[model samples]
Target: MTALTAEGLVLRGWEPGDAAALVEIYRDPAMLRWTRFPVTTAAEAEVWVANQQEGWAANTRHSFAVLDDERLVGCVALKRGIEVGYWTAAHARGRDVASRAVRALTAWAIGNGVTTLELRHQVDNEASCRVAEKSGFRLRETLPATPPWPLPGHLHLRTG
Candidate 1:
């Protein structure tokens, strides 16, 4: 769970030193729109990084800092029940970073005994749908809007 590479991207655990980079990428409102966790300032980003480390220690989450040749570009996280989520830096969008990172995570999870993985994104987020398809997560259902999840979304699943 140290570092995993897919295509030309590196998926590595989030480190405290990465707070600056986290703030940089998360400045994208598109990235903030999907999650309740918002990393704005350096202090906020530091807390976010700390939470990621805590998640790893608790074995409840697997959050990776995506890098392209050592430059931080995004984040991909897999929750305990196998739910997958991601966001690419504004500058890195349209480069298939999300799909490649998800695929790499799926491979690792399946190899480690995970049978299925889930991906969810708002219906209007067409880009996420493309990433889901590219990552081999098939559309399974459209979930009703619920608390914390503001809008109706598609749930895609990938089974080992």
Candidate 2:
């Protein structure tokens, strides 16, 4: 995928060298609570990065590392041209990193022929809700807790 840049942040394809930073980001307690992926070890992180590369090659998904001034700050991804997800490192919170990344990715996806994008977050996660809304997503429905999602969530949608 092409690298996207805006306001000093760059969203680019994941690289093997990014595994260590992925480990640190994924190990954050907030990340652990929100995502179901197993990323506790460097090996798992390597697998995660590999999966991202494979997904890109298959056209099933696109994952980007969010960088600020060349420092890894988070990630944003679009899956199956429908679902969108993102996370910001603890130090990057409160700076609108997630919202900016989401907006950038959303625009890129729509420009590439995707008609809509969706995001779902646990109902209690006000921060996520804000990010989705700030990035132009509207709450569309409520989904009950399921196997992967451990809590009720608000499903948000953005249509091009």
Candidate 3:
């Protein structure tokens, strides 16, 4: 419901117009391979945006569209007050977009009363691990593969 900005990146609430871009981002093989959400169609993208808004309204999650100079380049979110997740657009990769967004979101969440935040990525996702580290999260533990999430992962924690 609120917009945040730093270092030329704007973190804002999702809008209906973002559906196409969301679909584009989701089309990446890596995106589909790493996350649970697979928004392959416009309708699915709409649903994804709607769900984000719904979560925000319910106070269970906060999702932001990461923009670079007004162009959507990624997303960063806090779920259930303790988990943080993010993805960068293919064009935005290597620009430190995810890390910067995570740092900004972490600060916002902590200021809003969140005491701790967690980030987890599949064990092989070294990029995510780097982002977590750069964003001030430290590796905590490794979680065994579960039913839905079929791969082992490292759990990183950052306390406010």
Best by lDDT: 3
- Candidate 2's TM-score: 0.96
Model 1 clashes, total count: 0
lDDT of 1: 0.90
Tell me which of candidates 1 and 3 scores higher on lDDT. Answer: 3
Error of 3 at 62 (Å): 0.4
Model 1, 1-160: lDDT tens digits are 5689989999999988999888878778887887688889999999898888888889899999999999988888989759998889999988999999999989988988999999998888999999999999999999998878888999999999
User: What value does the lDDT take at residue 38 in candidate 2?
Assistant: 53
> Candidate 2 vs. truth: CA RMSD?
1.0
TM-score of 1: 0.96
Ranking by lDDT: 3, 2, 1
Question: Any idea what lDDT model 3 has?
Answer: 0.93
Worst 10 residues of 1 by lDDT: 26-35
Stronger candidate by lDDT (2 vs 3):
3
For model 3, residues 2-31, the per-residue Cα lDDT tens digits are: 999857899999999999999999888888
Q: For residue 54, what is the lDDT in candidate 2?
A: 95
Return the TM-score for each candidate structure: 0.96, 0.96, 0.97
